[model samples]
Target: MPVRALGYKPVYDYRVDQLGDQGGAQGSILVAGTWYCPSMPEPLIEATSDLHAGRIDRETWVAHIAARKPYRLMPKESKDAEGHQRMMCPAEAGKVQCPLKPRSLGRGVHLPLVDPQPSPTRPLKVCRQRAITLAPEEGAEYWQALDYGDEQWQKIYFRPRNSVEGHANRRKITAWLDSLARGGQRPVRRTNRRRKTKPLGTWTPTGHLTPAT
Candidate 1:
């Protein structure tokens, strides 16, 4: 039977140690993390409701549900007014046809089959023109050499000869800006050595610090 995901749900409640033999430790279940559990049939309804309400994430919910044993609905022999047996599983009622074929075997049967021809394999061709190498801009090497102090600036400036280079460059620039915004460098402080002094009746300059009376 096909199981459709109606929504999210809580699938397990016990510690990892309870799972046993599989080698897991007991701990509180994280909503979005992976979990292992033994299969159960009833609590799945409440778990699914919790998941849809944002109380749990899909990972833990799925793990809890998967740990439970699968339920199989067998078709009943009783037929309705239309002479059709009602579907045992409501989810599959409208879509799937019930198994109605009788179990039997006849005396003689004839069978004929032919072998299929194998498909032809073709050799893969490589184009030298398509395999172009990437090179840095003329001034890029100079700027990288001065800024990074490395001759390997070619590796940093050059990129794969493809459409993704622009996107990659944007990502690199964004990362650099984020790092700068974090204030990773320390600020430099300036020190003063000047001193102030006072004369007999008025203020005066002793060394660098002098006041006019």
Candidate 2:
């Protein structure tokens, strides 16, 4: 079964009859209205254009697959023997491995960053100015993790089920912190509007209040 988060809807598989004999057979799927070779990484998709332009050789194109980090196929509810959360690569089955590969596109070709970005979701805007408070103990861990700046830190802050805002105010605080750690500018806050008022009183010639206005 296709994973829910991927939003993958399997379409017809490519065959010789549909795409002609030269085109390879690969199952195609739609993701948020975009078609994809479910197993192909975004880098490889980009490499296809470079290959067509004669910038990268076929040998280098094939090597890109070996460098790809394995896809996460395990269900979110699944856990390893030690009761720790587990992830897996689709191609390697149960094994977990790094997905970065060395670039071999000869001179002048550049590869995308090895690490993927964190969630694109932004935190909810606050209605008022308030300090971001975190648990005293976890506060240190969060700061240290943000300072480290790696996938491991992301795993800690952006854990599954954390995307939702519940009673835990810390989630939103950590998200904003994570954004800063990833080089995002601190969000600008809107200034509060000054309250309007009517004239309060009338004054006599001596400057003493005589009556309410």
TM-score winner:
2
Error of model 1, residue 110, in angstroms: 42
Candidate 2, residue 172: lDDT: 66
- RMSD values for the candidates in order, in angstroms, are 29.2, 24.6
lDDT of 1 at 162: 37
Off-target runs (Cα >4 Å) in candidate 1 are 1-42, 64-69, 76-83, 86-213
How do the residues 31-69 of candidate 2 rate in per-residue lDDT, one tens digit apiece? Answer: 211222234465554443455567788777555433432
User: TM per model?
Assistant: 0.18, 0.22
Tell me the whole-model lDDT of each prediction, alpha carbons only: 0.29, 0.33
**For candidate 2, which ten residues in a row score worst on lDDT?**
123-132
Candidate with top lDDT is 2
Candidate 1 lDDT over 29-115, as tens digits, reads: 111122111121334424545565677787766654543212212233453433333223211222112122111112113211111
What lDDT does candidate 2 reach at residue 125?
16
